[model samples]
Target: MTQYLAKYFALHRKLVLPGIGFFNTSTQPAQLEFVEKTLHAPVHTINFWQDENVADNNFISFLIKETGLNHYETINKFSQFITGLKEKLQSGVALKIPGLGILTNNENGYSFNPENLQQYFPGITAERVIRQNAQHSVRVGEDEKTSVEMHEMLNKEVVKDRWWIGAIVLAVVGVAAILYYYLSR
Candidate 1:
């Protein structure tokens, strides 16, 4: 499987790993020249993007063909398998698919650990534009401020409880000492 994937990528410069994602290689145009005296060709660079649809389709087809099952049954089985694998990966476990690559979570997001050299993959490089979740930068309003203030008030109660606990301990020790003196007499 790994050899097949390696070769597929080597030939097509891209391979969509089932249940994982697509590995692509592409080239980028070189930096622009402000004033050119002579006519020269621009340089190009390679890049890659993971195709979720392709991966999902490949996974479904594999289940149907390999198990010789109907579409519904194969889909259910494949869905469960994919869900389990996704859960494992989301829970910080790396799924190493032979010849394909390793799927692991980083601090920022999920990343692929390709077995072959990155150059072989071609246009797989850092993205120029960084996309982020819309919910990540939610605006805090008056209600949110009130909630934060309420939490702060609860924190004060926690400190008050600690003080009361210390006072209770001292009172108990004093009573115990007085009882010990009377009993010893």
Candidate 2:
């Protein structure tokens, strides 16, 4: 299969035909809808697209073009290829065809979807499923200690400023008393 794809790429200078089976890249617009009788905010969705022409062709035609094999031989070859792919899926590795992209198990691991296939095709249903992963907890023991120490230092500076202000007020009162004593003398 690799050799066949390589030959096609070498001849066409592309992995797939431009219009027949090219890759499509587009961003799906965020949509808003009601949820639980309340309006839900819209969120952007990342979408990938690929051509359906590659999958549209029957196995026999592919075999005839690539291997120059007869109809019976082509069917047998395709069957074996599909069986091998299933075995690979059992091992947890997804199969990625060059122009078609990935084929992997869905969130349930029972059904599969082509990663790059477009959702707009007739009779095709593309559903996005969310998967949850393990949560992580962070601890900051030493960092918290340092932050507390910094807070204490700032407090001491504030106290020092208050002391300086008190000393200035005392000096001003002493000057006022001396001025009154001189005037009385």
Candidate 3:
């Protein structure tokens, strides 16, 4: 169930729980830091909002069609799940959705502290940064500057071509699994 929810969040970008809240994805843009000498990768975070009174629309039909589950049963399952989640939040317990962050209620409403994946890009792993900013300003010929540029470009390619983010990815997945198991129980 949690797996499907994660997948749906990834694919659809928005998921509404019948009486709990809806989850959507927001983008953090890539940035280049000249002073820091680093290029930050863009990433996505889950944004959750509570709206208990909203009507079921195309999402319901989409879920039923996609999962091949009975419409009423699907609704009931989601309803029960949302009810339990609400009860937990009302009880002052934080709910953690895998790949997402902790969901808790406050005086205003529910808030989600999204897990940061800022270091990793989709399908690209963050690699060990090997370049150090030059300590002193030095005059360089056009050919030398071009060579440096090519070296930086090649380094970026190497980082993108490798699958080195496996450990971080697994750790996140593991944490999500633990949270899911703990919550589902």
The estimated TM-scores of all candidates read: 0.38, 0.31, 0.55
**RMSD of candidate 3 to true structure, Å:** 31.6
Model 3, which residues run further than 4 Å from truth? 33-37, 65-67, 122-185
lDDT score, residue 133, model 2? Answer: 41
Predicted structure with the largest lDDT when compared to the true one? 3
lDDT of 2: 0.50
lDDT of 3 at 2: 63
lDDT of each: 0.58, 0.50, 0.73
By TM-score: ranked, best first: 3, 1, 2
lDDT of 3 by residue, 4-98 (tens): 66667777888776767787888878776666656667767777788887655666676687778998987887678778888999999998887
lDDT of 2 by residue, 1-185 (tens): 54664355434434432122333333454343424233223322222333434542433465478898887886677667656766776677776655435555445543324343334322323354454442334336554334445555557854234678889999999999999999999
Pairwise lDDT winner, candidates 1 and 2: 1
lDDT of 1 at 42: 35
Error of 3 at 70 (Å): 1.6
